[model samples]
Target: MADVRSMCAIGKHGQLGLNGKLPWEGTRAREFREDVQRFFEMTKGHVLLCGPRTRRSIPQFAYADRTIFEIRSSMPPAETIAMFPNRVIYIGGGPPVWSAYASFIRHWDITRLPYDGEADRFFDPAWLCGVRNGN
Candidate 1:
């Protein structure tokens, strides 16, 4: 397997979204994009694997030589990672997608937003628990 990585923009309460949009400002977005871009640049231009929602959520600045794939079934990730082991995956969406790929992800550049108290979406508890327990 290649160096599989994961990225996300999370809030203080482990929230992922609010009203179908990000919970951060442009500066935070730029910072996340810069980190991702730098990571890919150093890794020989690895593709950013993401779902359709995530692909659309991305701004123009975050665009790179990416290969966007939708999460239709459970077989694709293994296949994708097999083809591009040096993967820089970005998990941005509802809880399901985040939980599915959180384990394989090696790195995360999470953005800490102020307490919005309005985030309706969250990452899967199982994943978080696993990480907390060092599974």
Candidate 2:
């Protein structure tokens, strides 16, 4: 089996996106991007998955083979399991996708940004995931 991981950009108020975009700048934003890049590099050959919106959110994902799952509630779990059966999957999404697959996820790489703004898409605090603040 392959390793599984996920990443997302959240703003100060646990918001994931504002106007369909992440709101972080300067060092925080750069550091988040760099951390994601490192994750992609470390799992170069594995699959990186996300919903359509999440895929759209990322402006320029450097990985050549990033895979989009485009999650559908009607889809069966077996089908989801089949897509990345033996490899680690990294999901970068806003909310819908995160809620859908949180139970199956093994690890989370969340970035804590200053909560000075709001996001239409907010990350659920119920997940209770700890942050490994990146650079």
lDDT of each: 0.55, 0.61
lDDT of 2 at 134: 22
Candidate 1, after superposition: displacement of residue 99 in Å?
Answer: 1.4
Best by lDDT: 2
Per-candidate TM-score against the hidden true structure: 0.63, 0.71
Candidate number of the best TM-score? 2
Given candidate 1, what's the lDDT at residue 104? 65
For candidate 1, the per-residue lDDT at 120 reads: 67
| Per-residue lDDT of model 2, residues 98-125, tens digit only | 6665656677777665557655777786
What is the Cα-based lDDT of residue 55 in candidate 1? 59
lDDT of 2 at 77: 36
